[model samples]
Target: MLVKHFPGETIGIIGSSMASALLAQEAGRLGYRVASLVLQEQNPVRQFCNWQTICPVYDETALRHFAGRVDVVVAETGLLSHQDYKILAAITDLTLSDDLMAITTDRLIEKVFLDSQRCLVTPFSMVTSLKDIKEAVEYIGFPCVLKTTQRHLPQSSDHVILYSEEDYERAERKVEESTCILEAWIPTEKKASLTLVRNERGEMLLYPVFEVIGSGELHLKQVRYPANISSMVEAEMRRVAQVIGQALDLIGSLTLEFFITSAGVVYINEASVGLSSEAIFTLGSMSMSHFEATCRALVGLPLPDLLPRGRAAIALPLVDLNYDEVMTQYMMRTDWHFAFFNPRGHSVEDMQGYVIVIGDSIKHCERQIELSRLTHHPK
Candidate 1:
C-alpha cells in the first residue's frame, strides 16, 4: 500500500549526499518539515532538516526514533537496501516503490528484469567464477566489462574493463570474484538519460533528456541538456522509460540511462531512483528544479509538465583533478553556475562542484565547456 502526507507534514530522508541535500532543501521550500538520518560527520543536509538522527542507518534505536517523528520517509537508495526500506516502511511511511527499487538497485537483477520486458540491454552473462568469465568472453568478446553483483560498492570497486585475455588474470586481484556479470561494451555514439516521476495515481512527467560527453578513459568531461538526438530516438527513449514505469507501477522519480550505438540504436544501460547527482547536469535548463517535481509526487500532489527553459545547457563536473582549471575559468567567465559541496569526502573522484552554463545553442554551450578546459568527446 502507498502512503500520503500533506505539505506541512515531516518528510524523512536517508543518506548525506548532495542529492539528499537538494531533496531536503526542496521539501523545506515547499513547506514540508525535513528530517534525516545522517551518515557523514559533516553534511549540508543537517542544516536543511528540521530534525536529524546522526547514526548508522540500521541502528534500531535511532532509526525507530527518526521514523516515529516523520510522517513519511524518502530514502536515497544507493546506501540503503530494499530490506532497509522494508523495515522503514514497517515503522512508518516510505515513499519509494519497493518492487522498482528492489530490481533497479541491483545491476544483475535490473538487467534480468529489463530483458524480461524485452528492453534492449547489452548482451550479458551472469558469472560466479573465472571459467564463467572465459565462456562469456567467447560470445561477448574482448573489451567487455566485468562487474561485481555487489550493491553499494565504493566507486573504485565497481567494475573492471578488460581489453584482452591477460586482463582476466588481472581482474582476479581487483574485482570481488563472488557473483558478477560480464557485459559486452557497446560502441556508443552518445550516452543520454531521461528522468521521470510517476505517482500512485499513474500520472507522469518527464524532464529534459541530457547527453553525457565523456573522455573515453573513464572520466565525465561534460554534460549537455536536450541531448543531440533525433526526434525518433527521443520518442523511442520516452516509450521505453514509460513502459518500465508502468510495469513497475512506480510512485517516485526514476532515471533511465541509455547508450546510443554508432548505428543509432538506443540500449538501456541502467536505472536509478530519487534525484541523483546527474540531475545537476541540466540544472538551469529545466522549467522547474527536478526537486520540486519529485517533491510534488512525494507529497501526493499533481504532476506538472517540465519543459526546457533555455536553448541549451552544459555542466562540467569538478573534481580535485580539474578544480584549479574550472576555478580559473570561473574567474574569467561570470556566466557559469557553480554548485560546490561544503563537507568534502576522502575520495578525489567524488564530485566537489559543478560549473554549468546555459546558452542560446549547444554550440555556444560547447564553447563554454571547451573554454573551461574540459574536453567534450561526442561519442
Candidate 2:
C-alpha cells in the first residue's frame, strides 16, 4: 500500500544503514514518504515515523517492488546485491556511491586513477596468491600492511600488518581468504577527512576538513573541525579530493580519509561515496546536517546552502555498559545525550554505545568527558 496524497512518491532505503535512518529523519520531517527494507531479524514494525518497512524475499523482486513505490531509491553501505542496483535502475533513480572507495575497496581502480593522475596515494600492490604475496612484500617492503582490494564486505577490512617472514606466513591463512592489497604502513603524524558533496548540476560543497585522533584500533576517538594541519598539506588534501571526485564522476557526498606523516608527507587513506552525516555532524554541530543534504540530492534537489560558521564541535562514543550509572554520579556538569539510555528505544550494540556532547571549549569538552569515564569511579 502507498500513501494517497504523495502517490508514487517515496524514498527507498535498502538497509538499516546509518545514512538511511538519518535521511529518513529528514525526509519524514519534510512530509515525504520513506519506505525501507528490513531484514528478518530487524523490528519492521518500529521504524522511524517518517519511514515504512517493506520486506521481500528475493533481491530482484525487492528492487522491483521498491522501484514501483518510491521516487528515489538509495542503497546504504553498498550492502545491496549488484543485481538489485541493476533492477533499481529500471524503476527509480539510484544515486549515491558507497563511501569507502579509493583507500579501501577497489584498490586496483584507485591505482589506475593514481597512475594516470598526479594525485598522491599510499603505495599499494594486490596479492592474489602466496607467490604474489611474497613478491608484493618484496616490492612494497616489510612492515607493510595487507588489506582487501574490494572494500564491499565487512570482513574485507580485516587486515594484518606484516613485520617479518613469520608474520607474513602467520597472516597467510587469513590473507588467502580474499583479494589483498599490500601497502607500506606510513606512520601517521595526523589523520583527517574531507566530506565533499556535489549536486546534479555538479556544484560541489566541501565541508571543513575534520581531524580524527585515535589509538590506531580503528575505533574513532575524536573529530575536530578546521583541521589543524599546515596550509600546504591542507591545500594538497583538497586538490586531491577534487581530482578524485571528478575522476569518479561523482554526484553525491564523498568522504576521503588521509594520513599526514611526521615528515609533512600526506598519503591517501580511504573514501566513502555517500554523505556521512555522523562524521559531518561531529564537525558542523546542529547548524548543518549531512542528512538534509542527502535527502535533497536523492530527490534531484539542490544541496542545502550551509557554511562552516567556525563553531567547534566534538563527538565521542561511549562504549561501556554502565554508562548511565557513571554519568549520573560524575557527569553532572556537562551536557550529553546518552544514546544507550534513549527514552524512545534501544539501538544496536548498546554495549558499544555512543553519546554526543558539545562544548564551547575543547578543553571543557575533554575535561567533562574524562571526568565522566566509567573506569575512574569508586566501585
Candidate 3:
C-alpha cells in the first residue's frame, strides 16, 4: 500500500477551473512542480502553475504526453468521460481509481453504489423518457428534484425542482432528450458536508463538518465550519463517510454531503472525490485545508491534525464586482480573508471567488456577512 511521494516531483492537474487553480497553488506550497492541461488557451489557472499545456482531454495521444511528464495526475473538473479516465490511468498514476471516478461522476452510478452499501440515501429513480418520469414521480413522490445523471451535459441545467405537474410538463421535453434522476426532495433542517482524506496506508482523517447554505440554484452560497449538529449526528456522518471511502478504496480526498431532516434523519445527498469549494473556508478556519490535505494524500504523506481556530464563514457572491475594489475595502479588516480568482479576460459574472471571515461566535460571523452585503449583492 506504499504509494510514491511527490516532494520535488511534478503534479499534473487536468482542468482549468478555479478549483484547479487552488490545487496548483497548494501543490506549489508543498514544493511540488505543477503542470496543468487545459482545453482553452486563456485559462486563469495558468498563473498558479509552473507549466501549462493546451490539449483536449479526449485526445489520448496528447493526454499521454501530458501524463508522462508528471508523477501523479489529478482531475479537478469532473467532466472526464470513462474513456478519458482509462487513458489517464494507462499513462500515469491517478489519485482516484477509474472505478471511483466513474461512479462519483455519474449521479445514477453514485446512487447505485450508495444503495449497494446499504447507505441511507434519498428515494431516487432514473428517468430516460416521459413514461419513466411518470413512474419515477409515482415512486419518489411530488416536490422532487430532477437532475442530469451525467456531468457537464450539453445545454442543460444541472438540476431542477418540480413542485407541481406544470413544472414537470414544462421540463418534459428536456428530460426526454437526456438521462435524468428523480429524487424526493427532503425538507432539510440543515445541509452539511464531511470532508475526509484516505491515504495509501489505509489511514483516514476526517475534518470538521461544514454547515452549508445554498442559493436557489443549489450553488453553495455560504459555509460555516464546525457545524452545530449534535455529537451523535457528527459521529454518524463520520461513520458513513468512512464506510463510503473504504468501499471505494479511495486514496484521495472525498466529500460526502448530507441532509439532516427535522426528525434528525441523515441522508446522503452526493459525493465528490475531488476538491470541494468549501476549501476556502477550511483554509481560514482549520489548521489544514482540504486542498492541502488532498495534495498530502496523493503524495503518500500523513494527514495533519485539524485544529479549528474559531467560527469561520465564507460568502460566495453571485454578482460580478471589481476585484481590486473588493480587496481594498476588506484589506483593513484583519480578521477577514479574501481570495479573488484571476478572470483572465473572462467576464466577471463567469468568475469565482470567496470572502472568508473568522469570528469568535456565529453571530459575529453573521454580522460580518451583513456588513459585506452593503457592498456585494447575491444578484
lDDT of each: 0.75, 0.62, 0.77
Question: How do these models rank on TM-score, best leading?
Answer: 3, 1, 2
- lDDT of candidate 1? 0.75
Which digits, one per residue and each the tens of the lDDT, describe model 3 over residues 1-379?
3458667899998887666777888899999999989888887678788888986554778788988998888886456766777788777788777678778568889898999999999999988877887778887878998888777466434577888887867558768767888889998998889989888778887887887665653234667776888888899999999999898988888888999988889999988777776656776666777788888888888886777766555545534344454666566776666666655677754656676768877788877656655345344
The residue pairs that clash in candidate 3, if any, are none
- Report the lDDT tens digits of candidate 1 across residue range 104-202: 457788898889999999999988777788888999998999876656555534578999988988666544445777899999988889888888888
Per-model C-alpha RMSD = 4.9, 5.1, 3.5
Write model 2 residue lDDT over 72-98, tens digit each, in one string: 766654455444566776677666343
Candidate number achieving the greatest lDDT relative to the actual structure = 3
Write down the TM-score of every candidate.
Answer: 0.83, 0.78, 0.86
TM-score quality measure for candidate 2: 0.78
Which residue pairs does candidate 2 place in steric collision? 98-273, 99-271, 99-272, 99-273, 100-271, 100-272, 101-271, 105-151
Question: Which lDDT value does model 2 have at 60?
Answer: 70
